[model samples]
Target: MRILRTDIQILRAIAVLSVLVFHFDLPGLQKGFLGVDIFFVISGYLMSRVIIDEMDAGRFSPAAFYFRRARRLLPAAMAMFAVVTAVVPFALTMGALHDYVQQLLGALAFGANLVLWAQSGYFDGQATLKPLLHTWSLALEEQYYFVLPLALALIGRRWRAAGLVGLLVASLLACQWWLRRDPSGAFYLLPTRAWELLLGSVCALPGLSARLPHREGRSSIGFDSGWLWLPIMAWCLLRGVDSVHPRTDALLVCLSTAGLILQPSAMLQSTRPWMRPLQWIGDVSYSLYLVHWPLIALAKNIWLQKVPDTVLWALLGLSFVLAQLSYQHVEQRYRNLPTPRALLRQMVWLLVPLLLAMGALALHMHMHNHSQAGGVAQGQQPVYGFDARCDQEGDFEPLPACMNTPRPHTMVWGDSYAMHLIPALQASPPDGGVIQATRSACGPSLDMARQSPQDPPDRGQRCIQFNRSVLAYLRQHPEIDVVVLSGRWQYYLDDPVVDARGRFIHPGQHEIAASFARVVQQLKAMHKRVVLVSPPVLLGPDVDLGLCGQRAAQGLLTVMRTLQTHCAFERSLWETRQAKVNAMLTDAGQLADIDMIALDAFNCDDRHCVTVMDGVPLYRDFGHFSQDGARLLGLRMKLGQKLRASAR
Candidate 1:
C-alpha cells in the first residue's frame, strides 16, 4: 500500500522551505514560521495512522512507539547538539554559554520547549544566540509521541475519532484562552499546540482518509474552483514581520494544511517539473531543518562581521550538504534497527558521546567564569527609569506621583526612549517639575497605527487611545508650558509600512509631515512651547555594548582595535538611515516654531558615532542610554537650560 502520499512530501518541502526562508530572513516570507505548525499537523497524522492501524490489528505498545520515535528523530538531533557544543567556546559569549548549557540539558530531557518558554523571549535577540532554539519544536513533537500511544489505547479504535475530536476542541479553546493571557507560553508549550496535531489526526481517521477525494486526472483553476488559495492569501494579507504568532493566523495555517490534505490534486499541488526537487527536499527536510539555523548562528558569531551574500549562500549550501551526510549515515542507519530494544541500545550509545561533549563544554565555561570572577564588576546595573506607578504605558492617565508636582506644568512625552530620559529630568529639574506621559512604542503622532497594521491589535488600539489622551491633557491643562517630544524616530522610518503598489504608507514623507503638523498645531494652539529631541545615536542591532565592556578587560589597545574594526556600525548606515529622520524632525520643529535639541552633536562626530564616552558605555544595548550615559548627556547638552528657556 502506498500509504505515504507524494503530495505529503510536497507539503513537507513547503514547510521546510518556509522555515528556512524565515530564518534566513528572505523577503516576502514574513510568516514562514507557520512551517512549524504544518509539521505538527503532519506528525499528528503519521503517528495516528500507526497507532490506529496497530489498534485495529490488536497490537500496540506505548514503550514500542516511543522507541520508534527515538530511533527516527534522536540520532540527528544528538549529532547536531554535539557539533554545537564543540563550537560553543569559540562562538558564544560567557552569558550565552551558560544559557546554551541549560538549553542543552532541557533538550536532552525532552523539556527544551518548556525551558525556552520560561527563559528567553522567542523573538528577542537572545533567541538568535542559542543554537538549540529550534529544538523546542522537536521537544514538543517528542512529548506528543510520549503520550499518543497511551491516549489511543485508552480510547480504543472504534471511539478514537470521537475522542480525538473532543480533545481537539478542548486544546483549541485552551490555546485561544492562553494565547490572550501568555502568548509565549501558548506558543512554546505543548498543551496549546496539541489541537494542531489532533486536527491532522482527525484527517487520518480510517473512514475519513478513505472518504477524501484523491483525483489523479485534472486540477482546479481560479478561486472559484477551490478554497485552497483563500487561507494562504488571507495569511499573506494579514501577517507582517512584527505580527505575533499562534493567534488567529495560526488557525488559518492549520486549516489550510488540513484542507490540502483532504484534497490533494494536481491543480493545487505544484506541476511535475517542480515536484521532483520539492520531493527531494521533503525527503531530507528533517536534516535540513536541524542543521540550517545552527549553521547560520555559528557563522554570525564566528565571523563577527557582516557576512556577505556569497558567504551566506555558501553557508546555506554547506547546511544542505551536511544535512545530506547526516541523513545518509546517521538517520538511515539507526532508523532501520531491528527491534525496540535494539533502537533503545543504539540511542544510548549515540547519547553517551553527546553527554561527554556537553560535560566538556560546561567545564570550559565554569573555568572561564572562575578565572574572570575576580575582575567582574560587582555593582554595575543597567538603567531603566520607567516605573509603572509613574510613567505610563498604553494609556495617558496621570498617576498620583506625577500630579501636582513642583514642575507639573512641564511635560515629557514620548515612548520608552522618552522614559529613559527621565533620569536627566530628575538630575536637573526646570522651573516647573516635568509631568511624564510617556508609553513604550506609543509615539507622539496621531492615528499612525491605522496606517501601520504591523502593531498588534491591542497595542495599535492603545496607541490610538493614548495619543488622543495626550491631546486631551494638553487641551485641559492650559497652564502646562513645555511639551518635550522624544523617541527612537528611526524605528518608524526604517520599518515603513508599504501598500500593494510598493509605496510607503505609514510615515511616508507626506504622511509623517502631515502627522507632525497636526501634533505641533495642537500644542501651539494650546500656547505650549514644543521641544523636539533628535533621535539618539544608534548602534547596529547586533552590538551589545555591555558585553563588549566585559570582553575588553584585557587592555585598552586590544579593545580599541576590535572596537574600531568590528564593534562599530557602518558609517553609511548612520549617514543614510538617520538622514531622512533628521530632516523630518528639523522640518517638524520649524513648523511648530520650537527649539530642536540634536543628540548626535554630543554623541557623534563626522567620522563615526561613539559607543562609549570617558570609559563608560553610552548605550546599555543597541539604542537605549544607560543611567550614567543619560546623566552625562543631560550635563553636556545643558538640557536644564533648554527646558528653563521653554518655561519662559
Candidate 2:
C-alpha cells in the first residue's frame, strides 16, 4: 500500500521479467505465465489493504475507489488500443486485421477473456498478431474489482472478511477441479483466475498483517529464509506443469508470491546490484508490459527479412524509448490528475455512446468489405448453412452437394477442421471418386448423442436425428464408395464423465470405443472404404501464441518449438492413446471386413511430432491445424506419402 515495498517492487520486477523472458522464448521458462498469477496475488493484497484501511477510517467510497482504478488503468489501455488499432491495418494482412479488430473491440468492452476463450478452442497461427491479447489479465482484474467491492458492501464489514475468505476457498477449489477436467476453459476464464487475487486478499486481512513481526533491526534471517523456499517451489512448479495443467501450476505461483509478500526482510529487500536493472524495469513495468509484446512481434517479422541482431537491438531500444514517452506523456499525466468527481460523472455518462460509435464503425467496415466480396453468395458455399428444416444440432448433415448429386464418396466431418480437408479432396480426388461432406460439432459417430447430452433438448434431438439421416443417406446412396470421418478425436477422448459435483455417469473409455466400433461396423456393412485421420499433435493446450511470438522475437524457441523438443518424453504417453484408438479401428476393420487407413504416424516421426514444416505453422492452437498446415497434410495424403517423407 506504500509506494511499493522494496520486496514487493523486486517481486514485481521478477514477475514482469519472467513473463518477458518467457515471451522472448527463453528456454526453461515455460512457466513464465505464472508471473501473471504473482501480479494477481499482489494486486489482491494491495487492493484489499487499501479498501480495508479506508473502510476502517470511515472514508470508504465506492465511486472514488472505482474512479482511482479507472484513472490508473483505462487511459494507458485506451491509448495502447488506439495506437495498435491505427497501426495494425497498415502492418497486418487484411485477414489478420479483421481478427485483430474484433479482438480490439473485445478488449475495449472488457470482454477480451471471452474473445480469447472462444478463439483458444481453434488453432490460428495469427493469434500473436493482436496487440491487445495481454489485456485479458487487465480485463480479469477489472471484473474482479467490480465484484469484490460490491460483495463487501452488501455483506457489511462484520461478515465481509469471512465471506471473502469463503469465496476465495470455494473458487480455488473449483479452479483446481476445472484444471484437471477442463484446463482450456480454466485457463481462459475469470472464475478460475479469481483465486489468485483472493489469495492476495487473504494476505491483506488485518489480523494476518498484525501477526507479522514489524520490529526493525531484528535478525532478518528468518524473513530472508522465505526467499529460498519461493525459488525452489517456483522451480518445481515451472518444471512440473505443462500446458495441459496451467491453472494447477498457477496455484503454486500464487502461493509462492504470497509467501514472499508475507516475509519482507533486509536480505530479500536489499536490491542486489544486478537486480537494480530489473527493479528499474519493474518501475516502468506497466509500460514495459504494454509495448514489449508488440515490439517483439514486429521485430520477429522484420528479422525474418534478414535484419541483423544489432538492428533488432536498436528496435528494442527504440521500443523502450517509446514506452518511456508513453508512460511519461500519457499514463502519468492521466493517472496523476486529481479526480473531479463531476468530470468523472460526465465521462461515465459519455462512455456508452463512445463505445457504441466505435462498435458501429468496426461493424460497418466489416460488413462493407463482406458485401463487396458478395457476402455468402459468391462461391461462399455453406456446407452447413443454417436451414430451418435441417437439424442444426445434429452430428451430421448431408451437404446439398452430396444430397442432390448422389456422390459416391461419403465423408464424415465437423467444424473448420473438416472444412480444411475439402481443398485436399478436390485437389486429389480419393479412389472412390465421389465426395460427400457433413460438418457439425457432433461428429459422424453415434457417441455424439451420449457425449453432449447437455446440449439444448431440441439441439440434442436434432443432432441424433441428423446422424440417423446420414445413415439413411448412406443406405439410399449406394454409390457412396469411401467413408472418410474426421473430428477432434482428443476432445471426445477426455470427455467429462462427471458433473461439476463429481458424480460419474457418462460413458467411459471402453464404452466410447464400443460406440465408435458400432458406427464403423455399420458403415462397413455398406461396403464403404473407411479412413480415420487421427487428431493432429497439438502445440500444447496452454500454448499462448502471442507469448510464443513474443518469445520468438527474443531470440528463443517459441513455445511450439520448446514443446516439440521437450515433448519427447510425452511421445510414449501420446503413443499409448494412439495405440488404443488404432487398435479399436483395427479390430473394427477386421470385424466389418473394411480397410482402416491409419494416419497417426504421418503426423509424427521417430522422436517428435512436427508442428511447423516448410515455414508453415501446423497447429492453430493445441489441436487443430491451421488451414495452411491442413492443406499441406492433405496434399501429402493425396500424394500417398507421410509428412516425414517430404521433410527429408
Candidate 3:
C-alpha cells in the first residue's frame, strides 16, 4: 500500500490556504488559523502510521524517525529564519526586537510555543509582526514527536490503543478547563493540544484503520462523504476566529478533517484534473507556511503600515514566488542530497545561526542604545498609565492599587478606556479620592462584555464577573457617591457575541441600552451619582494615533493619512459609529441623577476630530488616551469640578 496519500496532501492545501487567507486579513476569512489544528491532525495521522508500521516490522528507530522529520522540516525553516534575522533590525523597534531575539532563539531550539505564551497572546496584533510567530505550531508538533514514539513504545501492543484514548480524553478535558484560566497557555502549549493529535493517532491504529477505509487506494464510503465533509470544514474555518481553540470550533474542524481522512472520495485522487492545483499547493504547503507571514510582517514593520487589499495581494503573490523557490531549491534538495552535499548543507545550517545571532546581537545592541526616541518604537498598540494591578484580564479580584484611595467619594469604573481616566483623575482629585473597579475589556455596563471583534471570546464571559465585582465594591463602600462609567462603547455595539452553537449574535440595541440604564438605576438606588463618559473622538480603528502623532510631529501626518484607507475617520463616519451609544447616553443623562460627559465637544471641529492637541497626542491607538493626553483632557475639561459635585 502506497503511503503518499493524495487525500492528506489536499487536506494540507486546504489548511495552509485558510491560514494564508487569515493572515492576509481577507474579509470573511477570519478563522484561517484553524489550518494549524488541521496540520496537527495530519502530522499525527502520518507519524502514527509510520511508527506503528515500523514497530509491526520490528524496525522502529526513534533516531531515524527524527532524522526524517528534521529533513522534511528544518531546511525550509532554517532558510526562513536566516532571512528573517536579517530583516529584524531594519523592521522592528528595540522593544520589539528584544522579544524577536527570544522568538528567533526559540525557533532554533524548537520551543517557540513556550516563548510566545510567556510574552503575548496568539490573537494579539503585536504577534502578527513577529516572523517566527507561526513557528510555535511547528515547535509544538516537534515536541509531540519527541513524546509520541516513546509513549507508544512503553504502552505495549495490546494496551497502546487504550492508552492513547485515555490521553486524548484527559488532555481535552484539561484543555477545556485551562482555557478559562489561561487561554494563551491552552493555545500555545502541548498539554491542551495533544488531544487533537491523539484523535488522529487513535484513528491510525490498525483496528481503527481497518474499520475506517478497508484499503489503501480506495475508501469504503466515498463521494457523498467528501461532499458532506468539505463544506463542514469550510464552515469551521470561517465560523469564529475568536473562539478559543482546541475548543468547539476546532473540534468541529478536526472531526471534519478526520472524517475526510477515514472516508475520502474519488475527487481527492491526484489523477483528477481539478485536484492538480490543490496537490501543487499541498506539495509547497510547508514552504508556503514558512515564508508567507514573514513577507507580510516585514512589509508592515518596514513602514509601520496596515495591509491594504493591494498590499495584501502583493504580499500573497510574493509569498508564492518565494515559497516555490524555497520548495525547489531547499526543501526538495536537502533530503535527497548526496553525502558530500548533505554534509555541506549541515555545516551551512550550523554556521548560519551563529552568524545570524552575532549580527542580530550587534544590531539589537546598537538600536537599543541609540533608539531613545521615535520611529516604529511606538506603534498602534494601547498604552496605559496605571499599573496592571487595577486593570487586568481574567478574574475580577484586584490588588490594593485597585482602590485608588483608602476613603474615596468618586469611583472610576469601566474598561481600558476608564483606566485611561486615572491620570486625569490623579491630575484633579475629587474630595473623596477615587476607587477604581475596572477590568480589561470589561466595561462598567451591567452586562454585555466590551468584546473586540478580534479578541478571544472568553474575555466577554469574564467581563460579566468583572462588572459584578464593580457592583460588589459599590455595595460594600457606602462613602463613594460618584460613579464614572466609561469604555470604548462602540466595541460592545459592533462586536457580536459568539453563542453556544458557534453562531455570532449581535445583542440588539435595546438589550445594550437596557444594560446601561439598569446599571445607572442600580447606582441611583445606592444613592451614588453616575457619570457616563461619552465615547471620545476616535481616529478610526486602523490608525495608530501615537504613530500618526509621531509622523505629525515631523509634519508627515497629512501625507501619511492620505495614503491610508482606514486610518483617518471623517466626522460623518465618526458620528455614525457612535450614534446608537450616544443616543442611549443622552437619554441616560436626562434621568434623575445621571450625567453624561462628552469630550469630543472640546476636541472636535465641524471637519474632524483632532488626534493631537497642544502637541500632546490626545488618544492612544484606536481610542484610548495616552498618559499625557488624559491629563491634558482632564485639565481642559475641568473634570474634578464635575466629578466632585454632589447629587444633581
Residue-level lDDT tens digits of model 1 in 14-121: 888888877776666778888888888888887887778777777877667777777788889888888888877666655556668788899989999988887743
lDDT of 3 by residue, 515-582 (tens): 77888888888888777787677645655555455444333323243323323446766677667877
TM-score to native of every candidate shown: 0.74, 0.64, 0.81
Query: Judged by lDDT relative to the true structure, which candidate is superior, 2 or 3?
Result: 3
For model 1, the local distance difference test gives 0.69
**Mind sharing the TM-score for model 3?**
0.81
Model 2 CA deviation exceeding 4 Å by range: 1-3, 123-126, 180-182, 210-223, 236-238, 241-243, 271-273, 298-319, 341-417, 421-482, 485-524, 529-648
Tens-digit per-residue lDDT, 1-648, candidate 2? 233566666677778867776666656776786777788998898888888778878998998888888777776666666565555533443334455666777877788887877665323444454566787888888888988777767777888778878888888787777765455567667788888898888788776742343332223344464556466546843674644444546767777778766655454455459767766766677777777777666554323223355655665676568768777876677676576664465445336545554565466446645543222111112222122222243444554643323454445444444554554454444544434444445555553542342222243334445666777777777776556665554444554332222344465455555666677778767875566554555433444322232222222332233343322224554566466555555554455444444444546766656544554444443455444555566677762222112211
For model 1, the run of ten residues with the poorest summed lDDT: 373-382
Flag clash pairs in model 3. Answer: 409-432
Report the number of the highest-lDDT candidate. 3
